[model samples]
Target: MDTANTMIRYVSPINPASFPSLSILLLAIGIFFMSWFIVYEVTSNRFTRNLKKELLVSFFASLFLGFGVLFLVLWVGLYV
Candidate 1:
């Protein structure tokens, strides 16, 4: 038997509560950007689209939103 050669490792889990401020900030920024994006889309002319502006806005909105939601879930102890 080679049981003596076996090794065990322990890893500490992340605690979202450690950075509540960061989570809140991200959520707020995400919502703000998303709202503006919606308004822009609704009011802007389809035929006169500005691809650069739209892409930039949408990218930031999605990025912040994804991270914000993820952090929020983790903060609430939903380890999904």
Candidate 2:
């Protein structure tokens, strides 16, 4: 049992505006990268003929990453 390793770590409360800023930053980055990936996929591969499917996959991937980061921030409390 590592008692020393477990404790309430917090320097301050999360600002109300920080959440929206994080969301916006996350979305902007997601869109930026998704655009590049979609363009690259379509241009590099001839088999990927369906734009809808490419978009769907990219959207899901962005969502998954965003949600994953959100969950981690919520559960772990980013900032110690």
Candidate 3:
């Protein structure tokens, strides 16, 4: 019995089959809607020279921010 080989065998904490598919979907949708709504509301009152460009930027910014936060939380969760 090789101790090195035995210790190197991998085990995953996350199993896809056990994950809640609906929650993932809801999370994605919620993020999209929340981001969109906030962007729309913020920009709706202001007169933008390029409305389309403004909205697009806002959407992506919010999306990346949300994903960044989610990633950090998930990373922490895995360790703690």
Candidate 4:
């Protein structure tokens, strides 16, 4: 009976959505960048003349937003 108890304890639960694919990450990144780029493009054209001239900076910002949103969404989706 002790062996059965240990075996049961050792057993692990499998969840299908536990591991999301790289594609999801990529999609999330795309969403973030696009969102930033869209807003930036509009504002730059509307107000500024030089338009900030910072693709790399925008890219990083997009990446941050993208990853953060992705993580939050994934976490909530999985748990809630």
Which is the leading candidate under TM-score?
1
1-80: candidate 2 lDDT, tens digit per residue: 98668976765465644765665666666667677676768586677467777777678668856854674475455732
lDDT (Cα, 0-100) at 56 in candidate 2: 75
Better of 1 and 4 by lDDT: 1
TM-score of each: 0.71, 0.43, 0.38, 0.36
Tens-place lDDT digits, model 3, residues 3-78: 8866866665665343345335545665776676676677666654466765675676666556545544554454
lDDT (Cα, tens digit) per residue for candidate 1, span 25-74? 88899889899888999998999778898899889989998888887887
Model 4 misplaced regions, further than 4 Å: 1-20, 46-54, 57-80
Ranking by lDDT: 1, 2, 4, 3
Candidate 4 lDDT, 1-80, residue by residue in tens:
56766664433253435426543665567676677676767676544634355576477666766655555565566442
| TM-score of model 4 vs. true structure | 0.36
**Model 1 compared with the native: what TM-score?**
0.71
What are the candidates' C-alpha RMSDs? 3.5, 8.2, 8.8, 9.0
**Candidate 1 clashing pairs?**
none
Clash count list over all predictions: 0, 0, 0, 0
